[model samples]
Target: MQRSIVRLAIGAAVFTLFALHSAGQLRWRLLDRIETFTYDARMRLPAQAQSQAPIVIVDLDEKSLAAEGQWPWPRDLLADLVDRLFDDYNIRVLGLDMTFPEPDGQSPSRLLSRLSDSAVGRLPGFAAASAAVSAQIDHDRRFAEALSDRAVVMGFVFKQSVKSDEAPEQGVLGPPLFAVEDAVDYVAPHGFTGNLQGLQAPSGLGGFFENPLVDDDGVYRRVPLVQAYQGRVYPSLALSVTRAALGGAPVSLLFDPPAKRRSLNLEAVELGPLEIPVDEQVAAWVPYRGGYRSFPYVSATDVLRRSVEPGVLRDAIVLLGTTAPGLLDLRVTPVARAFPGVEIHANLIAGMLEGQIRKKPSYYLGLEVVELALIALLIGLLFPRLSPLAGAGLAAGVALAVVGGALLAWQLGAILPMGVPVVFTLFLFLAQQLFGYFVESRGKREISRLFGQYVPPQLVEEMAARPQVVSMEGDIRDMTVLFSDVRDFTSISERLDARSLSDMMNQFLTPQTRCIQQYRGTIDKYMGDAIMAFWGAPLPDESHALNAVRAALDMVAAVQALNPQFEARGWPAIRIGIGIGSGDMRVGNMGSEFRVAYTVMGDPVNLASRLEGLTKVYGVPIIISEITREALPSDWAMRELDCVRVKGKERPVTIFEPLGPKEELSSSVRESLARHRGALQAYRGARWNQAEAAWLELARREPERRLYGLYLDRVRQLRVTPPPVDWDGVFVFKTK
Candidate 1:
């Protein structure tokens, strides 16, 4: 038990370090899958991508709306359209994208409200107006009575991230037919499942936002067949449409996660249908229509208002929806932007009906695991026994094999999660190569005794796995650079003696440095009491700027707690200036020929120092350049500081002073900034009086600050003695 525990602990520690080191880059977040990621419809693609559906779309176009009596044209008009299709045309099935959620305006209040624009969002007012419509249902009873038993499917949508809090009327269809489901299938640490909103569809089929799962790039690709929603797994619109078109016979879906597959076991003896287009793990490929014109479209008002000339609706399946300006039911498909939502359903129904549904086999993970294990075993267990070049060849061969195999499988209708496995195998291969180097060097030279004792155990394990990483050698990669300096370090250094200064420096640097390390930032080197670090490489971080900003914020908090120690020691409290920037540069061992030292050297590093310089100039503690600002998510609010070029860089980079941890800059500060920037622009344009007036407004709002003060000094000079006529908004720099 002890041996097993120790081995497990060692392995865990090793994997943890591996993850941390590789985690140097931005980690793809799996949080809030529903909100963050929007899906594509790939589940319907396959053999039917080229198939055509004769279903015609009766669009309630803006032109039709303008021609017919505007939107919400009386139900009499809708009834007339339905009657034409049923009696005169005979479309196989009629789908209504518009709902009669409320009364047909038989009530005077509803009629008055409709003409008065007070019914802005009161569509499908069925919930509230059902009682009034009770009489109408009996009166107009003609259309309502016809729909009561008609093969007409109605359209509905959920409240998906509404932009406003305007409460919408609930659909009379009741709660979402879909229920929240348990994790009944494969587990890859990601993928979504919930009970379907409406499990029992009254229509032929129900569709979902099976938005194709295209990579970072948008493309119509793959989709899942059985999406576990609410509690029951609901088929995609295409699947449901296909099943519905096929007369929806009972069939069994068998999922074998261990085998990495799903199958549709058809038992429909009536249709003698054993057409299991869905394969292992109940996934399929979606085929797309040739284009938008592939499906015939007839405006809704045309179908309802009888504008369609005869022969258009004969033997056609009619799907109805709006193309009115107010109805923004448009999606980015290989089709038109004015594409109707019903057409998407039509495509799915057509695909299913034609049995052109392609399946996306789900054994991708299992195959990836086996391949990774094989490669790992081959490299870790056998490749090390070969020469270096042979090992290199083997590793390269492994990578090529993995990539080629995945691509081939993709071509053959399979999409495996090969990213992690391929990465893990490559990591393992490189690790073994590095391990060989470490062992070889150990054999050649006397091993250093117990270096792991001083450093953290985690760091020791990290250093062991790939000792070359620990070597002075470094690689150039884009990383976040952080530079923080004590505001009055010069005065503090002078106040204390050599011992006292060293003590204060150690006292201050220890915790501040630890904070950076805690957030996975590398400590490049410390200058007196200042700390500098980067987030990429040695231990990569995709969110280096974010991480660096977090460390800076945390460092401030850490020093806040340590202020008592400074107060007790009769030393001045430390105020810090932090500047964070993200860019590409060389970060590694750099020293004289006599001795090499580990550090970073680049223009971005220099820019980081300049940004720190701006903190004092701007009277803000933490300043970040626009590059850093761009790297962050939109939620983080920051004020723009200056549009000045740093000393070394040619182009002007915007600088932003990040207000300390939610303590946002006051409105006064913001207004002052607007006036400041305006005055600066004016002053540079040689408009002295205009600049003075703007500066006056800014100064009255906020006290004299360095930036405004600098501009004021320039304005004073211009008022007294104006100089160059060719002046623009360029500030001349004299010092680096």
Candidate 2:
């Protein structure tokens, strides 16, 4: 009886842990990745319900390359292909999965323009002679005219800037049908590379060809229907082609009223007669038919040669794109590794047209959580009360139930995660069956196994080998603590659905954790989108501050690299503010009896959190307290920010920004730093005029830099309200 009670207790505890993690109270990235793999497996189930779709691809394949020469094929050839699709084949709609960012260089008009600019066209009869040839040989003008008043859709791409505040203007665009409320939360493209005006103007309908978003595994899954660029919304190539096919009907976005409180949640997009479901980001899953060549593909050369059969393409919507390996147009998709990118759009268009695309909405998460809890409860209660044989039968039954339920959902065209619940149920069943056998060895074994999940492999190994060194007792140590929080996270969260948001956060936080761990720092905990980490615990480092500073700088650079992926994913480009502080603090495994964590705590740790909050105020990405700056190497380039008392702290402390190694500083930056230092001195010495003049010059030189402008504002305000003669140069902050 006692053994049964103990076994039940352990099984329930285990089930609770796994069940909570499955419910998303605690995230397990490995399980999430596994869920994607499971989804990929289920998605491979052949979609046999629909007939051959009405979409055909005009592939610029290897055969076309061999017959028609290399890509950037003369605009005349493209113009010929376009005319053939609409005129000869009677295709319903023509979509170009390509862009023409510049005028065709091989055109006779360009040659004539060059000649007119030089001494050649200036000759007596040469000008008139070339003018006649130029008008006839202007291929772009010919292509533009061919597309005018036709069922044609052109493609363009959006390029996001690394510096979020500055965006370059390019290309003309048509506005989207719907306005996204709280537009800041939407994934917005800051800049774009678009088609030439001559070509774009005549197409009358076009959309961006770029994905700019992908799954966490870098596989093409969902494609966005619309993207916001500089407050204007534009559709994608797939959406545009569908719209054109539907007689140019404007798309209607259906939103969930409940989610509108956070930010608008796009439930579905309505075309003329078809309604397609999409996630909050306005993206839909590509309902792949099978592997590559799932749709009919006719070579562009065949279309141009007029060698294709009559009714094969008649009334079919044809998308023009390349499949040549050298063209680099192939992409990794859930269905195929080397699928032509064009087919992805075709699948989406066809799936939406047929209403076969599976949708996993936000409400599905609640359903999954409930299902997991019930299954976990059943396993926990039944397994403990049954004999070994009976328990085995019950466990198998539960496994079959979970898998059967998942398969039923799949057959009905919905994807719910089954890996976690199935794995959790089986684990508990086996653990209970083996509990009596491993009773003597379970104590140390379980501790080692559980600890291994949280700490680094090296630390776990040492703790297992020397158990005396591991304890829950507290100790004081001089350590460096770092705090990092995503800027505008609330808005970011509002842009994505639960699963997509989770995947995006995982994609972002994984690299950051690597940066800290790479610098030998231990992560204390994650507070939502913020990370709290420390160096010099369990193992002490004399240069913990220097290591923390290096990690901070690397994290900023890492985020810069991550922005492009984020931009591509239609998720918001993110920025992080980092704060680092080094001083004596408490370090140990601290928590209640139920759950303890290896972490650090002290005034210095609290101050690090406070400093991170100031990054937004300072308009900088990284900030550090004076103690951290003092511990750094002399070669480090540091700029004094301010001497202020934080809201919760009593004493005033100085803050600084580290600008990497001194040797790497540019000459212009070095000069600005010199001027900045002089300005700081003048401001502290009560020479308002000198301070104002210095800051004005710095602000003019770097107009985008807010620090210089901030100082200018301060100097101007102080001049109007001069400080008392005995006043110190300390600023007091009243909020954290």
Best by lDDT: 2
> What is the Cα-based TM-score of model 1?
0.40
lDDT per residue as tens, model 2, 558-647: 999999998997888999999989899998878889988878899999999999999998889999999999999999998888888999
Worst 10 residues of 2 by lDDT: 460-469
Assess every candidate by TM-score.
Answer: 0.40, 0.57
- Write down the lDDT of every candidate, Cα atoms only: 0.58, 0.81
Q: What is the lDDT of candidate 1?
A: 0.58
Supply every candidate's count of residue pairs whose N, Cα or C atoms clash at under 3 angstroms.
Answer: 66, 4
Candidate 2 backbone clash number? 4
Estimate, for each residue in 58-158, the C-alpha lDDT of model 1 and write its tens digit. Answer: 87888778778677776656667777777777766666655444555553445544544555435566446645554454323445545544455544333
Q: Residue 110 of model 2: what lDDT?
A: 89
lDDT of 2: 0.81
